[model samples]
Target: MTSFFLIDDDVAARCMLATIIEDSDLGRVVGEAEDGYEMEETVIRYAPDMLIIDYLMPKQDGIETIRRLSGLGYAGM
Candidate 1:
């Protein structure tokens, strides 16, 4: 099964997305986080096949987070 990791400051949004993904049989959520700061370790640990990140966040935006992850060699889609 495809694995997914979710990143968003909004708890409700995360929950809704997870539900949709699971209910639709799209994938499984391996992990989740509210912000991007210091999340590389967890993301690396989970090593999910995909990452669903919010474009806007309180601490770090999605683009920056993705860039940072990419720099650290996180190749998730």
Candidate 2:
């Protein structure tokens, strides 16, 4: 099964997405982060197959997050 890591600052958005993921059974939520600061650690811990991040977040943005993650060379499924 595909595993996903979600990062977003909004609690409501996170809840909604989590619900959808659970109901759809599309994938498992391996980890979640409120902002960029936590993303790095969470990503490293979870090593999810996919990362769905918000465009805007405190401390870091999606682009930067992706860039950083890419640099880490995490080849998720």
lDDT of 2 at 18: 81
List candidate 1 stretches off by more than 4 Å. none
After superposing candidate 2, which stretches have Cα over 4 Å from the reference?
none
lDDT of 2 by residue, 1-77 (tens): 88888899998998898889878998888888888774676697789988888999979998898888877776663
Candidate 2, run of 10 with poorest lDDT: 36-45
TM-score of every candidate: 0.95, 0.89
Per lDDT, the best of the predicted structures is 1
| Reference-based lDDT, each prediction | 0.94, 0.83
